[model samples]
Target: MCIKEGLRLHSPVAAISRETTQDFDLGDRIAPEGTMVIMNIWMYHHMEKIWGPDHMEFKPERFSKENIDKMDHFQYVPFSAGPRNCIGQNFATNEEKIVLSKLLRNFTFRLDPDHKS
Candidate 1:
């Protein structure tokens, strides 16, 4: 949950581009076939409508089982979505969990008292 929230707040990939396989209807406009489409992942992740008024805030519980059902699968795509989604997403997530677990078990983190903002 924490990892997913972190990814949502600060996605590593800024955007993704895909060329339309067919003529696509964009509601307000129509993108003809073979047109390149770029999705602004960061902007999508921070939308107030999809993520609620607290979209900008980090709240992992939003991804909790109960609340997760209310969300659109495509809305949060830190690793992108659909058929062209990241191939290494599963490996990457598992690696992140292992690394975080190891770090927590081996280290203690604290802010420096002598450091000034």
Candidate 2:
């Protein structure tokens, strides 16, 4: 849950560009063939409508089994999507978990003395 939430909040690939294979209609907009499309993942990650008012807050429980089913699969796509999705996503997520576990077990962290909330 924490891993998924972290990915949602800080997607490694915040934006991606794709060339249209064919002309497409996107509701209010139209894209001719060969058009370049830029997907802003970071913005989607923080959209209140999709993620709710606390989208910007780090709440790992949001990915809990009970809550996860309510969200759209594409709503938290840190690795982009479709055939072009990151190939290293699984490895990277696992690496993060291992590193985080080691860090938490070996050290303690606190806010800096001069830091302001």
Candidate 3:
């Protein structure tokens, strides 16, 4: 039995645009005034240092108990961290699970010439 990669790829939000309502200090880092900050999700995920040597590989074993717990929660963030993270992130998870289950039950998948799974 085999499984096509899941959660190995990420499509980051093109921009991180948000409005500030109040003044707050994030530890030593300070965000002042009505600042509009933008972050590139793809760049962060693809960085060699953050994801390690085989960051580009689709290795499900990366999510194993020992490794998962050891990883930096703040850095391996497909979904940006904090209160302004993502509203629909939960829905995406549920949807992925359902799709995976259905795929598992219905057919055998392979990396064929017709289509790339």
Best by TM-score: 2
Per-residue CA lDDT of model 2 for 1-117, tens digit only, reads 888888889889989899999988999998999999998999989999988898899999998998888877677789988888999989998899999999999999987999866
Best by lDDT: 1
Clashes in each model (backbone N, CA, C under 3 Å)? 0, 0, 0
Off by over 4 Å in 1: 110-117
lDDT of candidate 2? 0.89
lDDT of 2 at 17: 92
- What local lDDT score does residue 59 receive in model 3, on the 0 to 100 scale? 79
How would the candidate models be sorted by TM-score, starting from the highest?
A: 2, 1, 3
Model 3, which residues run further than 4 Å from truth? Answer: 1-8, 18-33, 113-117
The residue-level lDDT of candidate 2 at 42 comes to 93
TM-scores for candidates 1 onward, in order: 0.87, 0.88, 0.69
Question: Backbone clash tally for model 1?
Answer: 0
Q: Write the per-residue lDDT of candidate 3 for residues 1-117, one digit (tens) a residue.
A: 012123434644544666555664768987776866666776666678777787777877777778778977665555566887878878877777798899889999877788755
